[model samples]
Target: MDEVEVVVAHSERTTLRVGDVFLKVDADQSRLDVEVAAMGLAPIPTPEVLWRKPPALAIAAVPGTALGVLGEPSPASPAAWAAAGAAIRELHDAPLPPWTSRSVEEIRVDLDRECEWLITNDVLPADLIRYNREIAEIALRPWTPVFTHGDLQITHVFVDGDKVTGVIDWSEASRGDAMFDLAILTLGHEEHLADVIAGYGDGADRDVIRAWWSLRSLTASRWLTEHGFDPNTPGCEFDVLRTAFEAARG
Candidate 1:
């Protein structure tokens, strides 16, 4: 957006590329931007990318829009959500050899710390927290953790006509309880969220999945806050989490 042409690419990493060259900015808090571009040719799930000059980092020349329409509110029928579930199942099923595994014992090892987080932030709830823990222990009992999309949902899933074209944004991809991804996607505002998950080739527990999502609200809030990102910022689910936090208190 400076003298250089800038495009809003599907990526948020601040990168700059000129011709075959790439540029990256490594500043955390300087006059310039913090999310610098790094040259990467690795497999990514989005249509556009951000780049930088001199091939140092990835940069954006043109502001990019999502390749397909979103928020159209036209459920491609439960059939589409059903398909999306299959695609996600396959994705979750992929072996993440290079990635470390995740399990309840691993995440819960820090339970005392995670629980202290809610209390310290004044977002802790007694009944809700108790129920959340019980549900997690039960739900996570059946499924082994895997590398997940972390934020899979209707908005992040792109469909072309009836086919799922791409699963965008791997910024949050990591080893976690598979239920973590299922929790967010199957809940929220998607009208067909439940129907779709139920249609997965294998029956998945929905209530337990929802519990995983409810537990992460505070976890994400703390993670973002520490990283200097506000969860309540517009376009994010912070306010909705605020509602959940209050409901938990109730």
Candidate 2:
């Protein structure tokens, strides 16, 4: 008998693994709808959807380990990172998804709100918040939207022997800035940015990508805390923010 393993659990959702099948349970059906639809439309590899029964979607596990995890050193080689980047380029080059993504204004507003919360709650020093907020501004500028894996965390990408095997967790998939996907994938793994950009071909702005790193970390810290996650873990979001601060000063 295959014992169930809890992959992730939070107020919003829970994912369980039973042998080769992964079960995702979310009260919000819309996210599941997006995940299923995005996988169908995506040109790159995605997990096979075995079946779905309202509030629970089952998928067959794809081969290969995750590219990496947050707050940890990646076991994957530079070649694997480059392969993930190439796959991202393919996704961005595909036709846009039917759904609309949040506008720059919306993202800015969210950033402002999250920044204030950080200051008001004393989550981070006001100076740190202000500095990162300034850095975050660069990403607010306009850009051509692409078919993006909206939450392309390294853990969502799988690789085997320097080749990208699959990318999972497509609920956040939508039309968005391509750089945001690249930034998210290499958030804490900045050392691999060059390899990813090399595989992505061209048109990458390093400053903008770094700015997105600050913006994403600042905005996500509060939510991560509420969800019982520790963004302050070494090599995680807080570290990313601190690194940005240091770079600005030096």
Candidate 3:
């Protein structure tokens, strides 16, 4: 928390620290299709498992001025979202696993399970359950088990010279539908979400992407709220997720 020149981030326990070595885990499960800059790849950075004991830790690679700069974009302006969208498209194109420990059906079900946690904890709007159910009904059918970032968000991506220089946090990386990745990137930035989606490869379906985005947004929001995280905190991902939920719904 003092003055330091370098910092490290842990995937399992986030809260970056100022130090030479960074730590992260593979979670309690498996992650695939993950890469790190050390592997000679750019535009996508995955955490390198440096220590896999007790609480897993990994070495992280990042670019200058990412997350620290850019802040949040005004969806009213297409330029920011446009570029971010393109970057995400490139990220989606990055390699990922074709399957995870769970199937697409099971993963889709997690959205409901996450929301239910919110309801059981009395942290979600009661109507959220039905709203999400409708979303699932429409979104669940088109899922294709393919490579996914598992958790994709603008924060995880880094840009340099108009190119995505790096992408971070791979514990969530796994095999799933591309829409899941799309959902993570465009959930709240819906105003510009279209621009981002438009920039994506022609292979993806918009309707499916929107549904999953909406579902994941709600699931992530409830998670933060339940954990007592400040929803309005600046740079707080929970608020971002909630915003994505609204955007996807709209």
Candidate 4:
């Protein structure tokens, strides 16, 4: 057997890949609980949980390359992106999960807190933070909660051809704003937005989706930095923030 590959190791959790199995070791039992339950509830394909032994949950690997990577152009076809959109739509249409989701007020509070930290620490300019925060506020309105993959980064989705093979990293899954998922999936991949929305078909709000994009990038940068990632890397979270800043100025 091959040695275990470190998929991701962060302050919050660690994921290891050992051949056909993925071992997720996290100290937070609640997150693990949500992952397990969400996997069971999601209508789309998800890795089957092989077994669990506290602090570590093992699941069979989903067969396929990731749909895309952050900070890089996606090699996936438009069809594949659309397929992911369709899969997401199906998942959102499913019955709401039992878990609670964040309210608009809660998200606003966190966004304000994060923006303050970014400004105080000089992580970003005050104007940039303020501008993006104002843009993000557009999304802080009431929303009907649906089953959402809270952190639907492109890397979490696996695809073979134009079909969605599986979706991984379910710890953030919950009943939440559907546009939040759409925004996360297409975070830096803006060109693919039309394709995704086309597959999603109807009731899609572009403005709200863009608002979530700004909100997600703003709130995620500090954590990503602490977790050994440089959000300032071209085409990453910080770049997304910069783009928002430029647009706001224009």
Candidate 5:
């Protein structure tokens, strides 16, 4: 019998690993629908779907390990980081998905709301929240839409040696800013930004990417806390914000 392992469980969904297969359970079927559709449309490799039953979707585990974790140093070589960047460029260049993503105004509104919540709830220092929010403002500018992996977290990308094998968790995939995807991939892994840009080619604005770092950290900290995650973990969102603050001060 394959031992069932709990991968992640939150108010919105749960993921379980049974042998080589991963099962995702979400109350919202639309997300599952999008995941299936995105994987099918994506140019890069994605996990093979084994089966789907209403609220549950089963997929064969893709080969290779995740590129890295949020709060840890990546052991992957610079070439592997570049490879992941190349894969992201390929995905961004593909046809736009049918679903539209949150507009810049929507994101700005959300950021303001989350920042207020962070201050009111004492989730973070008011000064820190204010500083990061100021930095986040630059990312509110308009951008060209692309086929983006909405939640392109470092762990979502899998690579073997220097080659990208698959990218997972496509529920958030949609027509969105390409920079947002790049920002998410390098959120806590700023050290690899140069390598990633090398493979992604030109026109990656560092200021916009850095602004997204602040925007993402500020907006996501509250949700992460509510969802049983610690944004204060070393080298994570809070740390990223602090680093930004320090850089601005000096």
Candidate 6:
């Protein structure tokens, strides 16, 4: 295409926005399958599917700017955050996806592995790692699996004014803990937490959500690094981890 912009380029996938079309290129067909299925099942607004071939799926761009960016304060007003929160609540209240989510045991194993890697590489203070791990244990308990947009990063949401226009990136959508989605969306944007919770109405556990902040930061650093983004960048994942540690100590 004459005017193509690479929105995301990582080891796992590449997302290119050409004009009004978004082309996602991934080697894994199974993930594409999940994306297509999840989009079909989601109760909220999502990108329109233009077409799909192996290794690539093209979707019509939704109208509006992204809700926010990672490691940055959301430009969206509190009302936008609230609108996004309502969208998530609607999705969570829908029927569970056909696929299974990560078990607590599976998460614990990954946590242990990532924590060891972080310490071995001298990525953080050992005490910080230890404290976060202890705090993270609270989120490992059983939860009622909801239909979650597994990677609900701020960039995945589209908004016009205070209204949510669409949500994107459904590959990670599955039956999972609802708080995990909430945590992922609000990570690194702590100021918006109350806004989101206000929109969500009730029955949220802030402690568990914060625990996920620690757990996700601890586990995702390696993958993010391999994907070209530096998780250690100031005000990013490392900062999130440090924040979690301080909160636990207080």
In model 6, state the lDDT of residue 76: 97
Judged by TM-score relative to the true structure, which candidate is superior, 5 or 6?
5
TM-score-based ranking: 2, 5, 4, 6, 3, 1
Which portions of model 4 miss their true places by more than 4 Å?
none
* lDDT (tens digit, per residue) of candidate 4 on 1-250: 7898999998778999989999999989899999999999998999999999989999999988898898899999999999999999999999999879777788889999999999999998888888888889999998889899999999999999999999999999999999999999999999999989988988789999989888999998888888899999889888888898897678
Taking all chains together, the TM-score of candidate 4 against the true structure is 0.98
Tell me how many residue pairs clash in candidate 2: 0
Off-target runs (Cα >4 Å) in candidate 3 are 1-15, 19-21, 25-60, 67-71, 74-101, 226-228, 231-250
lDDT of candidate 2 over 25-99, digit per residue (tens):
998999999999999999999999999999999999989999889989999998898898899999999999999
Of 1 and 3, the candidate ranking higher by lDDT: 3
Top candidate on TM-score is 2
List per-prediction Cα lDDT, in the order shown.
Answer: 0.51, 0.94, 0.55, 0.91, 0.93, 0.92
Clashing pairs in 5: none
Native-to-model Cα distance after best TM-score fit, residue 117 in candidate 4, in Å:
0.7
Candidate 1 vs candidate 2: the lDDT winner is 2
Judging by lDDT, tell me the better candidate of 5 and 6: 5
Worst 10 residues of 5 by lDDT: 198-207
Off by over 4 Å in 6: none
Listed in order, each prediction's TM-score against the native is 0.60, 0.99, 0.68, 0.98, 0.98, 0.97
Model 2 scores a TM of 0.99
In angstroms, the error of model 1 at 152 is: 2.2
Local lDDT at 14 for model 2:
98
Q: In candidate 3, what are the lDDT values of residues 15-116, reduced to their tens digit?
A: 343453454434443332243322333244444445445444445455533422213663223444455566556655666544354665775678768767
lDDT value, residue 81 of candidate 2: 89
lDDT of candidate 6 at residue 105, scale 0 to 100: 98
The candidate with the higher TM-score, 1 or 6, is 6
lDDT of candidate 6 at residue 192, scale 0 to 100: 90
Give lDDT tens digits, candidate 6, residues 191-214.
Answer: 998988898889789999999999
Q: Which of 1 and 6 is the better model by lDDT? A: 6
Flag the better candidate by lDDT, 2 or 3: 2
